[model samples]
Target: MAGRSCRNSIPVAFLVAVLFVLNPPTGVKSDSSDHRYKTNEDVPLYANKVGPFHNPSETYRYFDLPFCSPAHVKEKKEALGEVLNGDRLVVAPYNLEFLSNKDSEIVCQKKLSKEEVAQFRNAVAKDYYFQMYYDDLPLWGFLGKVDKEGKADPSEYKYYLFKHLHFEIAYNKDRVIEINARTDSNALVDITEDKEVDVDFMYSVKWKETDIPFEKRMDKFQSSSLPHHLEIHWFSIINSCVTVLLLTGFLATILMRVLKNDFVKYAHDEEAADDQEESGWKYIHGDVFRYPKYKSLLAASLGSGSQLFTLTIFIFILALVGVFYPYNRGALFTALVVVYALTSGIAGYTAASFYCQLEGTNWVRNLLLTGGLFCGPLLLTFCFLNTVAIAYSATAALPFGTIVVIFLIWALVTSPLLVLGGIAGKNSKAEFQAPCRTTKYPREIPPLPWYRGTLPQMAMAGFLPFSAIYIELYYIFASVWGHRIYTIYSILFIVFIILIIVTAFITVALTYFQLAAEDHEWWWRSFLCGGSTGLFIYGYCLYYYYARSDMSGFMQTSFFFGYMACVCYGFFLMLGTVGFRAALFFVRHIYRSIKCE
Candidate 1:
């Protein structure tokens, strides 16, 4: 026994050593900051170029920043031009002016005339900000600082930062605009006895001209990032993989050896052959698929879970293959929304099928619930967040038209898809197949020990899955809140696969233990066991907010938690579905393999 223990220890020790080597504490850290301007490539500015532009009918109108001129402050129309003959239109560039430094204080040499100054003041009064693009990056330049009360500060000076812009000509006539810029107005100044202070300013603009196709331009922007030494995710990946391997090994061992022994003993029970007395899980095979209580709710949850699962897999695959590459701002959010909308049919189908199997008659209600269960909370949260943004006059707020369009998409596209899928599912299957006949009386569950109880098992099961993704979670939070770009979709995709495997394996193990303990109720328990990971994830979000992020402001806080709630909800559905499906398969395989009367 001692020697066998030592032999087992060797593999465990080897795994630990490999993980340590792969993910050293001081391994290279990758930054997704823009590095396009760092190169020596000459970017050209064309003054003769003119392009057609138009806003999507469903999208909010984007107003450009007002540029002050001698005649008046020019407010560029959001509708620049339209695509002609399936070709993208390129716009002419703005004239450039240089600033000079005198006595360590930088000043604009070409000062605006009195008329131009008046126009500039008018532009400021109208709250117009300059909008430009550099290589598919959008740069929004603010001329003044606004207070928390949404008022522009009178005493603060405005600083301008400029960088190169890149434009992509798309085949579909969708224009690609990119701008790179950053501003810093905070610098220490010395005040003398007379209370006079000296201040300095810095500003520059770089332009790069490229005729790259719209697709390639996006690819370039997404691929562009600061120099980094190595990917540190290898450590997290290895850690998660090791965990999954161990859990899978345990599950496989039990299924093959322990369950096989039980089957053999049951098969050879000659004394009870006439009476056909069964033991263990075989005793409950008849009731295992007897349709869980709260059938509609459970079906809805499963359907939504299936939808989210499919959406997640497809999104990751697209991202991994560079479909969302070039890191356009808001691209990820847009993709998720669109994909979820398109996948509503999957949710409806699963829910209807399950509900029908459970002998439910209210198909319409089930379909509605399936669509609303997850989306309802999300929409409400978004509305509240958008309201707060509008109150603060922040750019984050979606326009009323955009909001209406989103509702229309949900109502018109997603809702119909759900109905269609539900109809198909209900018509196809009404009765679920069970391995054995369910007894009229439900089996009485035995009281479990503390460790095997629902709460304890869920709490323990959740932590392992959470541990696998906590490291990646940090990077995701940084990208969202810390104004950093996350371009490593390949790593993200791998970690996501690991997370699903971990959730499934742990759920199966916990479900088996519960069944072994004579707990016939595994439906909700299996879902909760896997879904509890979301709770742990939310806890980590709290830690990230207070300890990792420098975020402040009530609006920011509201947005963070509101969006996080939606995220956690989706995670619960996805992971819970994974757990339930795995457990269902395990139960079916085990019961079907045994001899039963």
Candidate 2:
């Protein structure tokens, strides 16, 4: 046992080392850590992407919509996370120097042809917004606006583009503290005509000193574009805590009153043992530990779930420690991809060991299933979304090179580690240790009431857990689907723990009820009971889509539903595994206490 423990520790230690080495504990940032600047030094401004106000994910390159560029345009190389976040940083035409101010400088003069005018008109009509970054601080502004002047008549509407930009840069000593991009409505140019028109782009820069420190500059952007509704966030947390307390109260009844009575009745009264066995859960002790059907699939699902659980915990920890920030491009997604690839060993070991315990022989097939269980579905969904992005010429479409790099990472790093872990697990395989002996002939299960059926039990079991965290789901959905920033990592971590506890307690209670009814098939039932929360979550997603959000059109709609499906599936696997493990522990403890012949 000592030797086996030591061997298991080796893989864990190596994983930790690799994680720290690959990704040092640095907060996500776009620029160098040094903030001091020399006088008259060039402050490079990078143009990012533009999209309609309603659809956050549907974005195009800054240069895609007829934006003026430098004569010798240079592309800024971005990190993996940045690319995944659809950030395409390119050098802008405007020239600004540190501590230098300019007045009404002409950026460029353009002759708008018929096509150019139409493109501008369409963009303005859709309420397009553009994004840019100066020294890693982001700026957003509308490309144009529609003037109705409170008139309902379509003929009374006029479209105009802002041709002048005013940049206000705040500096503290030698460091840039903050930057703001403002457009004056008086500087608007009429683009309602199709005739050839000469347009002049003008910009002015003002440098002002500020008392704010450079280190505290990010605090301004930390507040989300939308309201945080912090009181509601706390309300959700308190709601989940109350649900957990309620479930805990029920679990306490089972452990203290019900299970205690059963243990006493079986142990103290040997004379009535056989009679007692004829009635409740004690009757199914012989078959309760029977190896479930499709054990390989069950094992693989559990393995993947374990990995996801670990990944989620670690990600939140990282977020709490400031390794990931809401404004840091795609840092969270990048960490997810990298860490998941590295932790394939966990999945392999878990699946292989559990499958061996179930007396499964096809190691290779089990290994394949474990590896592809989550990644396969995610890859397919991403590919489909990428195809749509390509068709729409959106920035969300990943370049071919990035795709190849990801494939290489998986093939070279993830697959090999998974195989190694599988080999280790196979070498250290052990038999399943069930306290109750199984009879050669399977015991007959009695017919159950409609209310006691698996489907009803699953629904009942799932609803409690879902209710605990349903409120939190709104904030999560808003952050992902809208413009809100999720900065409450500590609250999220607390809610996560609550979710697991609620899922476990509810599943265990249901498993006891199922066994009490003489239904020994509790393995998958417990899992489904816990995982049914995902179904409710998906249902809520539908409600949120139709009633809560303004998201529409094919690209945004497909992207929302498709990605959400994958997310819910992950929840299913993760919570299901939690349920199964808790029920297994409960069964083993109770059965071991009672006399099982």
Which candidate number would show the highest lDDT if scored against the true structure?
A: 2
Scored by lDDT, model 1 comes in at 0.61
| Model 1 TM-score, 2 decimals | 0.71
TM-score of each: 0.71, 0.93
Per-model root-mean-square deviation over C-alphas = 13.0, 3.3
TM-score of 2: 0.93
Instruction: Please give, for residues 1-597, the per-residue lDDT of candidate 2 as tens digits.
Output: 999989976754564455444433322333445756789887768888898878878989988887777677688877676788788888878887899899999999998888888898889888899888887777889988899889799767788989999999999998888999999789988888777778899999999999998778877765532354667778778877876797789677766698888778767666654454356888787898899899989999998998888888767766776766646736676777787887788888888988998889998899999999998999899999999999999999999988997899999989998888787777776888899998777788998889998889888878888888888888789888877677778878888888898899888888888898889999899888888888888999999999998888899999999999999999999999999999999999898887777
Count clashing pairs, candidate 2.
Answer: 0
Worst 10 residues of 1 by lDDT: 78-87
Give me the runs in candidate 2 sitting further than 4 Å from their true place.
1-33, 153-156, 224-229, 273-277
